[model samples]
Target: MKTLMKRLRAFALSGIIGVGLLGSFPALAAKTTLTVGAAATDVGTLDPHYATSTSDRTLVAWIYGALVRFAPGSTDPSTIEPDLAESWQVSNDKLIWTFKLRTGVQWQAGYGEVTADDVVYSLEKSRDPKRSAFSADFAAINKVEALGPHTVRITLSRRVPNLLGLVTNYAGGFIICKKAYEERKDRFGRAPVGFGPFQTQSIVAGQAVTLIANDKYFRGVPKIKTINYRFMSNNAARDLAFAAGELDASAGLANKSWLQRTTSIPGAVVDVFYPAELTLLHINITKPPFNDIRVREALAYAISTQKIAEYRGERFTRAPKSVIPSNNLGYTDNAGVFPYDPAKAKALLAQAGYAKGLTFTMLSSQLPEYETTAQLLQGQLEESGINVQLQPVEHTSWHQMIRKDLSPVVIYGAARFPVADIFLTQFYHSSSIVGTPGAVTNFSHCNVADKQIDEARTEADPAKQVALWQEAQRLIIQNVCAIPLTETSQVWVHNKKLNWGFDLKGSMSLGPLVTEQTSFSD
Candidate 1:
């Protein structure tokens, strides 16, 4: 509740900085600056641990560092490389791990040097549910102890499917400056400090968040001196802003029509990147109508994943192979899905005593991806005698409302660390059921696959782990916790002058990443 209040206060405080005033803080002649038009009305939070929105996550990666990180433009876990920790060693049993921290790494804004004590504090904070939205991801950690001023050791209660994934520069893996956080406390959500290439300079609430280059960055000093991450929720407005040369880069719509329209712009390059986000329709089984197995199965039969993929075009979207994303380890189409058949759907509804048809209201997001996906499902389900009324809300409100269990069906789309265990646990494990203690987005209140998910996380044998994950997916599908829809790749349009310092491929943050080598030239 306190966190919610803090967020509200931050938003309220944001109205003070008018958008027009951004011109007053231009970069020096020798330094370069870039303005990006993001698809958001405002930032949810800047603190990496609680940054869930794409807008916030995009900024989090810039302003924070983790023990390790996915290589620039890469989502593959095998590309995991050192960030704050110079090197690490793991015990043969895989429970105990020790890390050697890089010496003399400076923190942003005089926060002092990064040390083992800071790493230990950050890990503990990541483990505390009150401090982190991703605490469940750290449940296997027994403790983090500082062995020396520059060394830290982590002991785990049991082996996690991917320990490095948990500690990478994503989600709760972002390391925080202990002194800065302790000093800021609850206010740290808006004012975060880290050791990344960029530092939070200022936030103008509904307008933009300004970031300045961190000269003391360990990798190297960033070439782009300033970043103006502006909030332009309207697609047309963002496009216009980019066309007017007010934005160097902007978030792009995934549909082919939008792609064709934007590609004609002079010097505008559209980057459709890897590791597509998996969209799903999560049915709250505990809710009336959905509580009946026949009704749940009817929903599966009525919806068409192929149609959803086709809506966005195959170039950037594809039908998901399983409830788990195709790019994820252990993903298997053999889990089995109900084919789209209106006749079968109608029969199932008739058997469930709803022959006349059933009507239900769904609280969905107005965000392009979600709004379109929900409308598609609603139209398709209507043919099978299932009437869905969409109560569209803004993106932020939609996220909060669904977590309150107000939505019978949640149209959620996300890209996590390409791992099956992480996806299955957060979406199907009983422990992750929303509105409960330690919840992490189990919107459906799914519990059937909890056993398999738990066993798979601790399974040491590679083949056995894969089998357990496959079994879990099969169970979740049979029970109809969620119907997998389309997997859509991220799309963004950037100016030709912007150099990202790496070949852009994929980002776990679901957006482009700016690093020390990033710069702009005529």
Candidate 2:
């Protein structure tokens, strides 16, 4: 009886141990996922053609590819190399372009092989104003035609400043699988199909966007099997999540204090990138007293851009010397702008018939950068007896509201292809005036530089094109259409264990990219 009892206990112990081992097996088989914390409430869209917001742009870069692309870990236009297309050609006059597609590139979710037909379809969508936000950029394209299953050709209506920039993998240049998009229609943005390293798995609204590796990816399977992109709008919470090991990477605050605090985190690596985004305070010229040039000049004179730039920290930000960003092809530092004179600003305001002071309400984004800048602007404007009542709103909502012309003063920060024509056309051209047909982000409704901007677009001579752009900047600055504030570079932080495949550098998408070779070190 004693022997039998011992045998029974041994059998039970063995069964319990077996069950525990089974539980550990599943843990060992778990996927290697890189969890990321993005600084946004939610993604605006995943459709590459319309993905303007930073979070959306980041995801688009992972899910889609263009004919040519900026090399991984690079933002320089010169670093552009073949992506979907193996090779390409251009006509002597640069009016026609041809691309030869790579064979056997499989689309995600068994959407089948990518072909010239798909390229034709994608470029057409990019050219359509109703279908793409970047239609203005593709205006020079007369036709996109598929010569065969593996060949595509483009015909340009006029010579463009940068034809490669338009076709490269940024903004509307991202290719979409034709069959999948036609089947999904409007649901395509949510359920995307592309031939990139990762395939979209799921998106939990306001929570996370999960992507899994494409085993059949032409570039080779992504070593990191999955990506869990989470939206954490609150900066402090996002940083804490990273500190607690819940997030492998997170978008970082641009200011110095946050940088210092984050650097103190054990094993944390901070990346400060180049091609700073120029911030412009756009005064709506069509609205109220702002229609008067004196009022706009007064506002410009009242706020010292030097002080505003320094407030964000000298390392992260720099005062703009021209309407065009510092590094652009046609940037001119000699564009005359008003001096910081509070007394002069008051005189201008009084001349514009607001001697007691002018009060106006401006909608401000809750995003830390915009809100802090708005507060700083409010205090500075008050010194010249100009009152600006700020009404804070969510960042996404602020983007929508400002587009609807709800805000008289729109503080916008953006970086485009390193060119003067792009910045001038989108922000100062009469064609891109806000609230009009074919309008873009022209919050000021500025049309003063129409001639210079229009001429610069097709200026055949390089020097003449640059000259036209410089003159446009001078005209816009003199008209006081917008106050060029500062340029703020992108900042992000990641775990030291994380290897982003390429060296840390500038990214056009304004974030670090996780490529096929990306992995975490033990």
Candidate 3:
């Protein structure tokens, strides 16, 4: 009781003192340093063209500005605004997109003006499959031709209704400086240059990335002077650091217990947001037992999404209706495929020639969230006579094994929203088979949802197009390619005095971290 009062008094006194000194010692009264602790050791790449991992995206946002950007710190796709391109127009047929670039956008590190050539070159590189993991995003563009120094035209083979959404920083929307790239080549990945509100002061691979505010930022310069992003992979350690004031913010964990405990700290503020993340389990259809549709349906019936969401903590979790999460564009409620009915599960199992029930090994990551959820699922499956042997493996090795088609079941958690076609094609199209043709993330190795996906992409009318996407989602659910367990919320704990520049709606990248608009109140 005394400790709490003491801490509370200290905050009050600090605020009072800060306010009193502001007029006389304004510079000394302002707080300048902002530190963000992330739960990652390394980024996949620093090059904006190929940086796709969470860590990479978070840091890259500081350096790059996409042609179009999602409204800062917002998950709402409707709030997209112009970046390098001041305006854009699409042809009546929607196959051609013309952009009017903004004038006088300066590049970092002595690079010259950002021009049509740079925009076209950056997008073309993003379109090359060999160079970019996100090439699939830019694959629809037939050609990117520069009309002039300040104008660019893009020709698409067919209509892309969601192409505008894909250009955001989270997607393949970041523009690059061609001159800087040709001069640096592969070295550009380590030392990137861009025109954003902040620029990299220094970066040490796998350790920390330091950024200084861009004084000449097109948008106003950030009130905070420096942002130090530290890599702390351990959840407990990261949380402890935030609680002790070593960190101003953290990557925000999914676990609820941590949130409950951390929010109790004096002057700490915790915000939870549904950041388009879905926790799902993938059933390999090519595997012997799952090859039978009845077996897949039986397994689905056996696992209870309600129970799974409950086990994951209902406060931060919601039961997912299908493989396509509710946050995505084509979301529809066809939740009837696998309602929790053990009797129906057993009957289907018997019909599939497994009268005594079936047993399979499910490979899960060694991370606490994955391991604990797997164990909880194991208990839930027993209720339906579906025996599952949960094997915990290293996170990296687990992903490799699942992609290799080794596990009978693989648990995956990802979110592709606003542009639902990504989930539809990458996880459902047969050509997207992980180790095959496209070398995509499609571990299901099935193509039942391809037709609907293709139709949705080219559909001219927005309403009818949505129906096509809904049909594709229904197909994935009915076919039992994967089982969605829950929509997990990511949580961020921060100091109360830290003004994050924007209200916490949700972030597609960094969860409630400081931005150019962010500053300290005291």
Using lDDT as the measure, name the better of candidate 1 and candidate 2. Answer: 1
Candidates in order: C-alpha RMSD to true structure? 11.1, 4.5, 5.5
Better-scoring candidate (TM-score), 1 or 3: 1
Which lDDT values do the candidates have, in the order given? 0.89, 0.88, 0.77
Give Cα distance to truth, residue 383, candidate 1, Å. 1.8
Q: Put the candidates in TM-score order, highest first.
A: 1, 2, 3
| lDDT, candidate 3, 76-167, per-residue tens | 78888888889999988888899999988888776878899998888998877666656766658899999999998999988775777767
Tens-place lDDT digits, model 2, residues 1-522:
999999999999999999988966644532378999998888778889888777788888888888999999887878999999999999999999999999999999998899999999999998887888778888889999999999999999998888988888888889999999899999998999988898899999888999999998898989989899999988889989999989999998778788888899999999888668888999889888889999999998998988887777787788888887887899999999677999999999999899999999999988777888889999999999998999999887887788788988898888888889888888888777777766678899999999988888888999999999999999999998899887888888999989898886788888888789899887
Score candidate 2 by TM-score against the native: 0.93
TM-score against native, each model: 0.93, 0.93, 0.87
Task: Sort by lDDT, best first.
Answer: 1, 2, 3
Superposed on all Cα atoms, model 2 deviates from the true structure by an RMSD in Å of 4.5
Task: Kindly report which residue stretches of model 3 are placed more than 4 angstroms away from their true locations once superposed.
Answer: 1-29, 182-187, 203-206, 350-363, 366-368, 382-408
Model 3 steric clash pairs: 167-173
